[model samples]
Target: MSKLCLVTGANGHLGNTLVRALLAEGYRVRAGVRDTSDTEPFAGLDCQRVYVELLDEAALDRALDGVEVLFQVAAAFRHWSADPEADIITPNVQGTRLVLQAAARAGVERVVYVSSVAAVGHDGSALDETSWNEEVENPYYRSKILSERVAWEAAQALGLWMVSVLPSAMVGPNASRLTDTMGFLESIRQRQVPLAPDFHFNFVDVRDVAQGLIRAAQSGRAGQRYILANERSSSFADLLRAINAVSPGYRQPARAPRWLLMCVAWLQEAQAGLGGRPARLTRSQVRLFQGVRQEYDTGKARRELGFQPRPSDAVLREAFAYLWRRADQ
Candidate 1:
């Protein structure tokens, strides 16, 4: 009998892709979606739907029934809010706890937590499972750090079979046109964005992330964390040029002084805090430029789980192609 895999946040870009991948691999998929009626994206897919919230005990239990593996991909993903700490902190930490508990209660064989590289330390070093970004003075990063801590504690306490996969700057075509990465790419392609940072990030393909999650579910070592980074960390200039190569009108941003950007960030933060609206330059967004360069030691994943990520350029080209086609439609 094929194992039953429950994927939370099944309607999301990554979650939805994961479900499709799981189905392709012959696992029965149970998608935990908040709205059962919004099933158009999952239409004709070999998957069942579980209408539930992360904290809904009864509903969560119902979803966990007969679930041999669980993929915790759901999280409150937002940066600017009146109480960002509450909006991000509670759901991520509490929701993860509840999901793990539900999995343990249901005797699930394995659980894969799709964490972010935001949880890793940004000390200009090649980060891996052992490193973490606990010292960052930002809300979103703090929330991710706290969530990973929660996962670690739960793994130790329940003796649960779990592995954490931390992916950096997930870029792919499926992200909505409004997502941060997609928006950035779109603006760059349209010559609407400016002030590109002179920095780099470990960009991972969303398809690779989906693949890593599946590998984690099957062959991953329990209680371990894996950093899923592409072979090369692309510079902002390189990224701009890559997009420009495809989109004729794509333009690069003029570099701005770091201090000037800091002032703008402060003003944006103050305005949002007082007006209860989204901030232009959130603390997370600010630190993203100032934080340590994102590079990772994927040797562990290679030796253990046979993870071989493609080049960043290849993924970016594919994403650009997909976006180009979608925009034409």
Candidate 2:
């Protein structure tokens, strides 16, 4: 019998990549997704598709049965929810607990949890896997940090080997939807953001992130976390500049003071509240990004998993070309 692996959120960008990688590695894969109608990405590959609703304990428990390794990748990702505690936190925290318990009951050997850089809050220093971010006031960040903690605590109780992989802002082609980096680039293309945040962030190629996750499963220490980020720390303006170098015709957005941006965010959020949808701008973003500069050292991942993330310029160039081609089509 082949080694069995379960990858939740199999339809997502990273999940999709990991599924293919696992199949190539000769592991029998169980793809846990909400929809099976569109397996276009997995065409010609034979695998099992299981419907996974994160909040549904019975469904997740059944999905975990007979799996040797479980990759928990499904999480609620948003800055705001109609009810933050109920919608975001509850589902993520509860879902992780359920998966940890189910995996233990099913006698899974190891669980690899896909965490986010949001869980590691910003300090002015070089971030490593040990850095814990305290910006829990932001609902999305709070949910991720709390959910990771929930997974770790459950892993401790269940005596399961667990490794967490944290990915920075991701850049790649063929996005199924507008993710954070894509949305930011879209804003630049549309010239919607007349003012940009004068902050810096580390980014990684989605391909590298996917590869790192697999390496974590193979080589990461039990109960250890790895930052799957490259040395791509730069400001928003710099990122746009790189895109403009490839795409051209993009004017750099002016930098606005954090206070002024907060006021504008409040106004936009208020208008969005009246319109009964989440706002594009919010106060939480201000707390998270405004005037903040963060970078990470991936020495642990490099030494342990032989993780080698690519440079940002090459990744951003391919991303811009892909987006431009889509625009032309």
Q: Pick the candidate with the highest lDDT.
A: 2
Query: Which regions of candidate 1 deviate over 4 angstroms?
Result: 176-178, 274-277
Question: What is the alpha-carbon RMSD of candidate 1 to the true structure?
Answer: 1.9
Worst 10 residues of 2 by lDDT: 173-182
**Across residues 9-117, which tens digit of lDDT does each residue of candidate 1 receive?**
8888788889888999999999998988987768789899998688887889999999999999988776667886678778888888888888888998899998887
TM-score for candidate 1, please give it. Answer: 0.93
lDDT scores of the candidates, listed in order: 0.79, 0.81
Clashes, model 2: 1
lDDT of model 2 at position 99: 81
Model 2: how far residue 119 lies from native, Å? 1.6
